[model samples]
Target: MNITSFLIYCIIITFTPGPTNIAILSTVHNFGAKKAMEYTYGATIAFGLLLVISTLLNTILMTIIPKILIVMQIIGSFYMFYLAYQIYKMDTSKPTVNQSGTFKSGFLMQFLNPKVVLFTMTVIPSFIMPHYIAMPTVTLSVIAITLIGFLAFITWVLFGTIFKEFLQKHKKAVNVMMALFLAYAAIEIWM
Candidate 1:
């Protein structure tokens, strides 16, 4: 359990710009950072749930039924498309005044995001030595990865929060940015 190596990989994966960050930052610009926290919490929980499910199933099911990977990939892709639609519709100008739904939405979006699943299933597991590592050790390594990922996401959300004012002030620019984000998301799902 080389915690240092795990942390490095986690930082790389979490900090790299992706759908979750795009969604959260846009939400923050529209609704304020406080409201954007909901999405953050949601994403965090979703990540944890995915980690547990994959870890467990990786042992019992994935070994015997390799096709679960394909199912997960398909589900993930569908969810990403749905989220892209959501983002495409987001009116940064008249975003939901009530901040209640942001967290749950963020969490669920992250949970089903195909990109997240792909990275978790393919990239994350490679960092740990499954053959030499015990289950608990592997679990702890994943937990460490989760913690770092969550913190990095929160940081990005905060950056978006701080930039919200600028985004609001430059309405036209913000719209372009949001549109670009939507396009990126669409491409990700499509690919």
Candidate 2:
């Protein structure tokens, strides 16, 4: 496998402004980096698990029930919408304490996110050569991807943290924006 190609793939997957990153940003702005990092940690684990599952079941998925992927997609989108609502309703005035285990929110969100699933199905396969690549190598690749994903999310969360000084003044606007973002993600799933 070409290292550059894999690196490029990781960069794209990690940096994209998807639901996971959006949630982290919102959480950071409303709660703070400490809470947001929890989400990132959870999300990273979820990401690694998804990759491993996909790699192990690649043949099964590639052959049988490829279409059932749509189900995962729909479920994921709905979850995103639910999370968006939570973000929209967050009480920015009171910084929320991290009640969910350090990474519960981030972990579950990333684990269940359809967007991430679709991305994994689409991109991960390209890097993996089923014939040449051994399972151990694929597992390592997944781990690398997960680490990159964690860092990318951290960057977005930090962006929110930096913007908090300005965003705090306009909490209502941010809520509306979060609501709109959720709606857009849901609509995309249907399309």
Error of 1 at 93 (Å): 5.1
* Candidate 2 C-alpha error for residue 89, in Å: 3.1
**What TM-score does prediction 2 earn?**
0.87
For TM-score, the strongest prediction is: 2
Which stretches of model 1 miss by more than 4 angstroms?
A: 1-5, 60-78, 92-95, 99-101, 129-132, 189-191
lDDT of 1 by residue, 73-185 (tens): 56766665565565556665564666433767877776567667766665335666544468787777678767876897789778987777787787556656665765576
Off by over 4 Å in 2: 91-102
TM-score of each: 0.79, 0.87
State the RMSD for candidate 2: 2.3
* lDDT of model number 2: 0.76
- Error of model 1, residue 183, in angstroms: 2.7
| Model 2 poorest ten-residue lDDT run | 123-132
